[model samples]
Target: MACDREVRRAVSGLSGADAKVYELIESMESAGIVAVPELCEAVKASTITFVGFSCTFGDDGERSIDIGRHGFFERKTRSRTENLLSKLRDLEKDVRFTVFIDDMEFRRVWGWSRSQESLTEECEFQIELAREESQIPGDWDVELWSRVESRIECIPKVCLNTELWHQINSGVACAPINYEMVLKWAAEPAQSRALDEIARMRQTYPRNRNVKLSELRASSVTGLAVYSHAGEVLEFLHPGAIFIHSADHRRDHMLGYRRTKPLPIIHPWR
Candidate 1:
């Protein structure tokens, strides 16, 4: 069977009919929580999987799989390690079937396969990381941001590629956001131009449409939230890697930077 080899290899360590349970426990651990003991005791199983798989790099220079691990470690000092690897771990879990896009800004690029079927319960990226009144005027409405979680079909899960780099604010960084519908709605009657820009780019880079919210290096890059706040949303187009270029490169970038064809105005994703 196509899955028998995988199932055999997966359960080789645990042995017996407990592989299904082991799979479930491992799934839980991949979300920053380790409840294996509870699962083990409840299921009357003695064997427990220590952890999920890890990324094994090779000289092939042509393939990669960022395993998504979110469980706490065994060491007492693992807390520090947790924070350090938080972002990286997030990427491992958020985006499934990940294929690299670029070496220069790998976080900025990735190919994603849709897992919309995984959504048993609705999970929105949630908007607004900060409290209200803390937000500046002309910026996003924080309270309004929270509502999108329940209302929208999808939400971006922003994060940096590395936690250590994120804490110190190192690197170009990115916020792997999932908010599109509400964000487009947030643009209001005036910001139709930005929405149009997003659509045009999306058409060229159709793959970017289903970005795994955790795969993109969110870092401190503004607007990583699900709603259309100034910082949580994509300011311009998504950064280069996975991003497709406009047919008219001369018209790309700020007004004066490109002295060619005028960029077209765009409305929100309808």
Candidate 2:
């Protein structure tokens, strides 16, 4: 498919680790969460732009990142973007870029794996019915969910386990060839603060209520998480669609790709 080829082309220069991160982000997007503007902006300003994504590395390395930090590079000229992307690609060959996913994100993906239908089912249920006051760990706001539910009410459920496995078995090149685990650690309970900020924004801002509401809900629903395989806490960041790796080395990064909508086929052949 031209689109699939284009998707591959967009991530051409990334290392296996970095590519997997992009794939995970795509999965989140497929599920209807907006792209992490910071990461997307960074990629756009760099040489490579993911026309779209569908797609890890594990090793010892030093990293400087935050658990929920967000930053973006200003748009650059084509030449500069290419140059920066080239440098990052070149550096990757020798330095080994790694994808450090958080346990929550790991669980999401893992839940898509065989033997976790129950977990995915539970997750889906929570996404659909859990309220702000619910004990569910990452429930979004009721008002936001109400709007989102209407938008995504009709999308079919995604069998992530089957689809992902099929892609892996078919030798899809959208993600890393190997699933490496650097460290298994816990994710911080920082979602509450994020939710609080969303509440404030919803109450204080009158413009673009639906858009803001959806985006705010999306932040809690399907943002990409950036983690460090070297086990370092990423710097602090504002409440947005971006996140840091983890709080300690025991866990490199935990990124949960959630959504109110159905997951899309990251790389379609047709």
User: Best candidate, lDDT-wise?
Assistant: 2
lDDT of predicted model 2: 0.29
Model 1: residue 28 alpha-carbon error in angstroms: 30
Query: Local distance difference test, per candidate?
Result: 0.26, 0.29
TM-scores of the candidates are: 0.18, 0.19
Writing each residue's lDDT as its tens digit, candidate 1 over 203-240 gives 45466557543332232121211212312221222111
For candidate 2, give the lDDT of residue 240. 20
CA lDDT, candidate 1, residue 144: 24
lDDT of 1: 0.26
Backbone clashes, each candidate: 17, 20
User: Every model's Cα RMSD, please?
Assistant: 22.5, 20.8
CA shift of 153, model 1, Å:
17
